[model samples]
Target: MSTMDKGTGATMRQTAKARRRQAILDHAKRLFAASGFRAVSIEEIGAGAGISGPAVYRHFGSKEDILAELLVGISEYLHAGGAEIAGIGGGSEGAGGSEDAGASVGVGESAGVGAEAREGDPAGVLRRLVDFHLAFALGEPELIRIQDRDLSALPAEARSSLRRLQRQYVSLWVAALRRHAPGLSEEAATVTIHAVFGMVNSTPYVVRRIDTAVVAERLRTAALATLGVADVVAYRK
Candidate 1:
């Protein structure tokens, strides 16, 4: 093969390998989300991924490594996704980004909301964030479950990395919120951002009593109000 052809073939091989690796991770997510991380076994993950147990180790050294990759990968994914939502160097078009974010977090699309906020549309930016994260909370409740209950189970380095990514994600919200409410201080905005996350993250528990549309609307409004947008009507739509 020509040198460039060889390079292309090698790249294809790597891509194929990564796809197989992700298949394993996808199955592990379902198993981990359905059963607690501790309850899930390597052999089971292998079976779910249609691979032998020994083959699983070729992709991941151990079960903990898979879990760590899952948690850390999602954290990194969320941070990157939030960066795009907040317009941090994310240019106007962001469709491919939408898919990557949704896939990494084990959620589907965010209703085609990859568009950057309109010029002079600060509320638009905030709305984008609210809409995006609400979709995540609703669609990936299992991942959320792992985040809330099993975070401490991760190895120390992974746990720390996860926390760091989470904090960066919150900063994206804080930056966007400041545009809507200039009076918001760093500390106040941080608190508001954290509280809003807690509010939306409650979706899994409350989905039974109310329609998701209603839940999403209430959260968007409440989050805007929390950011001190007194007239949230303009933004809630």
Candidate 2:
């Protein structure tokens, strides 16, 4: 066979291998999300993907590796999304901008402000942080569940790294709260942010077992309530 033919064949083989790897990961994610990490098996993942059990091993060394990939994927997503929201300009249209400057504002009200103003308005920045988190959790329920359930299965170092990434995400929100409500101590804001996160992250599991509309309404209500609480707390003290 010609050298060119051999090279083309090799490229095709590589492409096919990558596709298979992705397929395995996708199927594994679905299974892990549907059933906690402990309940899912390599064989089940492979069967769902129309591949043999050993084929999964070829792509990921073990179930833990698959879980690692899923968590890493989520971490990357949150990092990128947070950066994007932080980069928005004050004049930008859509969800990231101010409707009017003269309106009454809460201590942490600036948390929801656009990326451009994130540096200037703590409350706006905090608002944006919450929005970014809720957007991700509400949009990717399966990924969230998988991450929450399988996080402990990851190695210590990997777990630490994931925890660091999560903390960094939360820091952005805390900073905004500090700015908007200068009276509140750092410890207070930290606890409040954690509480708000719990409310936001719980929506996925709730949605799975109930009607979609009900889930949607609950998510909205929860978000608004959290924001309202943040606003009240920021200004109250």
Top of the candidates by TM-score: 1
lDDT score, candidate 1: 0.73
For 1-237, candidate 2 gives per-residue lDDT tens digits of 999999999999998887777778778878888888899888999998789998888888888877776675566445444544554323212223222210111011222326445357554555556656665666667777777777888977668766876776666666656666778788987887788888888866675667766665565456646544344333565
Q: Candidate 1, clashing residue pairs?
A: none
Model 1 spans with C-alpha error above 4 angstroms? 1-16, 90-105, 108-118, 205-211, 228-237
**lDDT, each prediction:** 0.73, 0.64
* Cα RMSD (angstroms) for every candidate in the order listed: 4.6, 10.0
Q: TM-scores for all candidates?
A: 0.77, 0.71
Query: What is the C-alpha lDDT profile of model 1 across 1-237, one tens digit per residue?
Result: 899999999999999888878888889888887788899888899898788888999898888788887777666656666676665744213224545645654666433433554466777777777767777787677778776777777988878777877877888789888878888898998888889888888765657477877876777778767766544465465
**Candidate 2, 20: how far from true, in Å?**
2.2
| Clash totals in order | 0, 17
| Candidate 2 RMSD to the correct structure | 10.0
